[model samples]
Target: MPASAFDDLDSYIALPRVEALALSPDGRRAVLTVAALRKDATGYERSLWEVPADGSGGPRRLTRSAKGEAGAAFTAGGDVLFVSARPDGDDAPEAGQLWLLPAAGGEARPVTRLAGGVSSLAAVAEASASVIVSADLLPAATTLEDEAVLRKKRKDKKVSAILHDAYPVRHWDHDLGPADPHLLALDLSALDDTIAAAVADEAAEDAEATMDASTPYPSSLPRPRDLTPAPRRSADVEGAALTPDGATLFAGMRRSLPRGSRSILVAIDVASGERAVLFDEDGVDFGEPVVSHDGQTLAFVRRDRGSAERPFDAAVWVCALDGSGARRVAADWDRWPTQLVFDADDTALIATADQDGRGPVFRLPLDGAPVLQLTDDHYAYSHVGVDRARGGYVALRSSWVESPHPVRIDADGAVTPLATPAPVPSTTAKLTEVETEASDGTRIRGWLVLPEGADAATPAPLLLWIHGGPFASWNAWSWRWAPLLAAARGYAVLLPDPGLSTGYGLEFVARGWNAWGREPYTDLMAIADAVVARDDIDADKTAAMGGSFGGYMANWVAGHTDRFRAIVTHASLWALDQFGPTTDDSEFWSRIFTAEGMASHSPHHSVAEIRTPMLVIHGDKDYRVPIGEGLRLWSELAEHHADDDGRLPHRFLYFPDENHWILSPQHTVIWYQTVFAFLDEHVHGREFVRPELLG
Candidate 1:
């Protein structure tokens, strides 16, 4: 692999990325979404593709359109149904519509044309063709046509204001406003009949009728029935699953509390419009419901709301469909399960969890047996699709060395690549895992990316890159925070899993819950010390950088020590008190922090002690940390710091349209260019070079 591969951002963004996988009912065919940069080079477009479940044939593209497709699923009949925004030639709604492609090979056609677009899709496992979808709805609108009219009227009147009686007005990156998400049940049988009639009529018109056949035929679509006809005020439902018989639907509904909101699982009868609470506890939130194929058991996650002493912990819980014999599964397993599905026999469950430094799949038995480890590798697995007939599963596998690709995991524990749309980058950097002992004797582990030509004779500069989610581990491949770019610039990047990081047990996370500036901080420094002592690392030319919680740590590091030549913080929480109240998810933070705790741990108070050169990066639409934190930190630095010249020893890079992350292709390129330039000027003692894109 050549180092020049990482030097160009265009080539990096052009690489095909794979996400989400769905298997057919028979498990012989699998479909996954692939996103690639559009021909215009402005943004990415996603399309559905089919791959052989046995990893035998080349992947074939299924759908191609200017507006791409996503949220793919296989109907019980083995037909592919996906959501897309392709425009209908007639007076159809402009938002996303459900489209279908037959398993026998045919042009994809729309199934429904909802006004506000389809947000999610689900199907019954046993039934032939029963489906449920969710879409955004306008206030007081009963039908799709009415909602469309309301949208047009609002657009004509230029009414953009949203009247909210709820506490939260915005989510992570978007406003949670005038319209809300609502569930709808699609009449798939009726839709199939309508399409069949249209095709028959065209054939009957002439025996020699020869249609273009390649182009999609738009038939009269069937209207969906509103499941939640009259939802509660500001209600937002998610994580919906259907029973094998398609008679019942289980979903998570958010209910507001004094400090925050908690999601409780509720079961809805598909035909009678009757709803019942399946599980609801006082301090524990429930979500991600998965019903067994036998329809006798229901499994979901229970998350405990934290206090100053204990932070949140997610555990898997199972209960009978009749709301009896509820118990927690995998009670002894220290790792937390994210997504799971029941095995074919319904006697065991398979799930993926962050462990050590990788996300591995685990099998938990309902018969009181010990949990079994299914996968042991450096790659992270997500969006798992199980094939009961083959007794195997497929998942999107990714690691630091490779991008996401579809891989089949056989019953015998063997993994084979199903599709590789993008080629791996050519690089000479070596990726290795390292571990060190903290002052408290706790073991800290991290991934070290040593650049090419880095040896004792020519030591490489070091960059300590901390991960966000203070709760998440660095186990997966990330194009955004890729270390290859830094390694291309002759820097060795260290991605450490300090305290509060997942994959470690609860005891490890509890070490930094209330003492954010204590254990986690020290664990990070301890690992850095171990790496700096390596013969191939330049100890003096080191820098620290992070985003979100990692950004918060970078701020803390800048103020506490002058060991690093420079520091970079992005979307960081500087003043915990102010941030706790102003953030989008304020209630979650408020529940965990006390007034004294905020005062003692916040990085804002210690800003005056900073003597290192710093680069502060933030996005205006970052509701997670909020732009106010960046403004405050920048203003404080300008007021408090002064170098030999009149200029302040700091710089600020602001993104007005971006959210917490710089997602745009050009913007991402500029981000890396600016960061490298800053590090070079400060750490390498080189002249400051401004990026051409910024100018």
Candidate 2:
């Protein structure tokens, strides 16, 4: 494919991608979720695909449904188990439910028919047939049938009300409750045996039912027992892994604290309803638990809450199964560990961390040795599946230049491609790494994408794109804020990692902690100045854009300087005090920020100083930086410029159904088109072009 082909937003969104890889027990086969455009090209649909662990043949599609299949896992017998919303021909609920595909390659059939439907899946290591599923339950309903009846009653009454006692009534993009996520365990050993015998009996009675059937034969499915009993309000368990013996389950559980909520590792007895906190420490958060194959050792990531002087630091900690001898591993490693997994023999750990300019995989030894850096590339890896039997691992690798695909990495640090669903469009621009020194002499770095025709004589307009997460880095590929799309439009895109970005050590992050307008703001300006000085960049045509925390910075930049021609802030925080009290996870932020700090740093407090045209974009369902922020920002901009005689050009783009991100394919196209039009009008002195779809 020519690089120009992907220059179109439609073609870019149509690219086939894969994520969520799960390797089988014997390391002979793996399954992953592949997302492709639906038939009408309106949106993407995800389906499960299987590939060989030996990296021989291409991936084969396993399940196809309108609802799509995800959260894939392999059972002990090598059968594939996944969650889907596909309706059974009969009376199945409309939510996601567990389905099983036989190991020998047959029809995928429903494994569990719960009322709330399965949200995620986990299998017992020692007993592969045993599985645990998470589902939503009404506040008082105890059983699946009761929950189903309650849902029906609510539907019949057309009621949509929720009662909450907590400070937060919603999450990133959704309401927190009427129902809460609950975990249930299903011992499928007896059901599997019964189904096998029933199938044999059916074959003898009716040959047609045993052959070419699209669904599994009707058999009695077992009732899953509730592991998280009632009375445990507001308890959330996720990332659960069963022990090798299947006697205990270790998972990350979030419990309420005085200030907020903190995640801790909990060990639950598989048979009894007893649970114990395995690792708990004050001023710390623990999660992502991985147990060794022998079930003797546990490895998890521990994050130390930041102090007034330091930022948050994450490190891998290892402890015995009995919750003793807990010690930090690779204490000197500067990078924060994520997506951790234990090797088969339990001697070492494989994990991914944001490092420098990329998210790289690292192998950390349990004996406190230096961490080994594996896979030296610009791409980032996630949903890693290890094949200890084959002495290798498979992960979904992605980069700014390409979408994610499944790749295999061997012990010798060799990366082999496993599946290629679609061709990556050739780029119309080249990516280069650029660095500059902050005001404090601290080194700052970022990626610069220069357009195809950009040069000394024909300079391109620059877009200073700031990443979200004041805590995250722009090290991975993002379909939402793609740089290639901007490059194709004859723009040089600058993705800078300022203060509070990961990959950099805690000290670097500390520079911006509690002080949003200090180092991070200066560092961004320093990098922008460096980019503008380049001969290939048109400094006068530069514009600034950001989302979330980046959005907050954009607002800050607008209030502090008139350097940029225009500014775009999406889902930004306008008033720190209002945002802190109303955001979905209020507790978490309240614990980290003080009222005085909020008032001092909030951009809304200094709105009168703004002197630049702006485009404000927000989604109504964005609970993280909620729609209120955008409303307040727009109001402030309007009220401050009421006497400006309409000289300042400002527009507001709103999404009613969308959340923090503009995810709909059609909506995303409009988003980019509108942004380009706004930039052209303000920065290039071109006429404003309204999006046709919006009209």
Task: Name the best candidate (by TM-score).
Answer: 1
Best by lDDT: 1
lDDT of 1 at 214: 21
> How many times do residue backbones clash in model 1?
1
- Give per-residue CA lDDT, model 1, range 1-695, as digits (tens): 33466767767777777877888888887788888887877678999888888888778889999899999988878889999989865556678888888888878888876767787775444664567887778867765656766887888899999987767888889887588777777767767545576676356533433542221223345567777776643237647788887888888877777645788888888877688987788888888889898889999888887788887888888998766898989899988887889988899889999999999878899887999988877888998878888787888888877777888897766898886555455677889899999987899999999999999999999999999998999999998899988887899999999999999899998989877899889999999999999999999899999999999999999999999999999999998888998998888887777777778999999989998999999999999999999999999998789656758878999999999998887788788888999999999999989999787
lDDT per residue for candidate 2 within 601-625, as digits (tens), equals: 9999889998888999999989899
Candidate 1, clashing residue pairs?
A: 1-426
Q: Once model 1 is optimally superposed onto the true structure by TM-score, how far is the C-alpha of residue 58 displaced, in angstroms? A: 0.7
Using all chains and alpha carbons, the TM-scores for the candidates as numbered come to 0.95, 0.94
Candidate 2, superposed: residue stretches over 4 Å from native: 1-3, 122-127, 192-219, 231-235, 307-309, 643-648
Model 1 vs truth, CA RMSD: 4.5
Q: Give the lDDT of residue 444 in candidate 1.
A: 98
Query: What's the lDDT for candidate 1?
Result: 0.84
Check candidate 2 and list the clashing pairs: 3-426
RMSDs, each prediction? 4.5, 4.3
